[model samples]
Target: MKIVVLNGSPDSRRFELDCYLAELEGLLETRGHVVKSFELRAMNIGHCTGCWGCWVKTPGECVIRDDSQKVCRAAINSDLLLFASPVIMGFTSAVLKKISDRLIPLLHPYFEIDRGEIHHRKRYERYPAVGLLLERATDTDEEDLELIRDIYARMALDFKSELKFTGLTGNPAEEAADALDRL
Candidate 1:
């Protein structure tokens, strides 16, 4: 599988998630899967101004000139797109959210009914399946994780893809990769 890992850790150098992702990358490579990753904080990603430029002025591309374009391309092309982040205030870090919001360019402005709910039309022929790799907070509970998963599940629907799984950094990286391999 061709996997693109969006490392949403705010501190790439200090976070243990970085090490865990590295191990997971190595394991995936051993299985002959192409693995690529992006350190979101290190890149020049900007906030989404909700200008709708990507949907109106320029279809399928954002007006902001930043590293998010690279992220969008990688995400659109990959077989699996892993969103990895440390839980901050019961959610993913701000940097990750910034990029995630900027990903609006990849969806069309039109809406459709999916499971009796309105959703955006897909802009791409195929969207990569999404996986969540979260690092829990000190006071993290099961509810927080479920909330995160539920939100990402809706996000998967927006992209016309599946929510593969939501794993944690505390778990062995090998196990995470093995889960993907099985899929």
Candidate 2:
């Protein structure tokens, strides 16, 4: 399996989330899965300006020529796309959200009925299964986790995929790897 990890933790120092991802990456690689991780803080990725240019002028591509293009390509080509971040103020970091918003180019401008709800059509024939790996802050609670999960589930649906896994840094990396292997 090929996996792409979008590391949205903004802190440069040694953080818990980064450590968890390092271990997870190693385990996955050892298990014969190719892993590609994009450290969002280190990359040059601009915020999505809500310009319909990606949908109109340039179909299936973001008009903004930035590192997000690499991210979009890796995400669309991966078997699993994992969103890893530290929960800040009860949600994922802003950097993660920024890149997440930029992923809109992967979908077509047209809408299609899916599960009785209107969703954008897929620009690609297949999209990666989505997963969430969160490092909880001191103030994080169950409600926050649930809300994040709900949002990502909807995001997966919008991407024409499914949310395959959700794990926390509190768990061992081996546990997370095992869960991913099951997927």
Candidate 3:
């Protein structure tokens, strides 16, 4: 499988999340999966200003010319898109949220009924399946993880995909790799 990993750790010096991703990447490579990872903190990504340019002005691309374009491109082209982050203040880091917001361009402005609810129309024929890999905060609990998963699940639905895997840095890298393999 072709996988794109969006590393949302804000601090480059933090090795806990980084180390886990490294191990996971190695395992996936050994399994013959193509993996591409992005360190968001090291990239120049603009914050989504809530402007409807990507929807109205630009059909499937963001108006802002930044690293988010690269992220969007890789995500849309990959089979799996993994969002990795360390839980911060009960949520993912600000960097992750920013890039996640920028992904609005991947959907159309028109809405469609899905499961009796409204969701944006898909801009592309195929979107990558979503995954989450989180490093829990000291105060993080089951509720927090569930909340994050629920949010990502909704996001996957919005993207016309599914959240197929979720893992933690606390777990063995092989476990996460195996989960992804099953996908």
- What C-alpha lDDT do the candidate models reach, one value each? 0.90, 0.95, 0.95
lDDT of each residue in 1-183, candidate 2, tens digit only: 999999999988948988889999999999999999999999999999999899999988988999999999999999999999999999999999999999999999999999999999988999999999999998999999999999999999999999999999999999999999999
For model 2, name the residue pairs that clash: none
Runs of candidate 1 with Cα error greater than 4 angstroms are none
Let me know the TM-score candidate 1 reaches against the reference structure.
Answer: 0.97
For 14-68, candidate 1 gives per-residue lDDT tens digits of 6588898889999999999999999988899889999999999999999999889
- What TM-score does model 3 achieve against the real structure? 0.98
Please list all clashing residue pairs in model 3, or write none if there are none. none
lDDT of 3 by residue, 1-183 (tens): 999999999998889999999999999999999999999999999898988899888878888999999999999999999999999989999989999999998899999999999999888999999999999999999999999999999999999999999999999999999999999
Q: Residue 117 in model 3: shift from native, Å? A: 0.7
Count the clashes in each prediction. Answer: 0, 0, 0
TM-score, cand. 2 vs. native: 0.98
Candidate 1 clashing pairs, residues 3+ apart or interchain: none
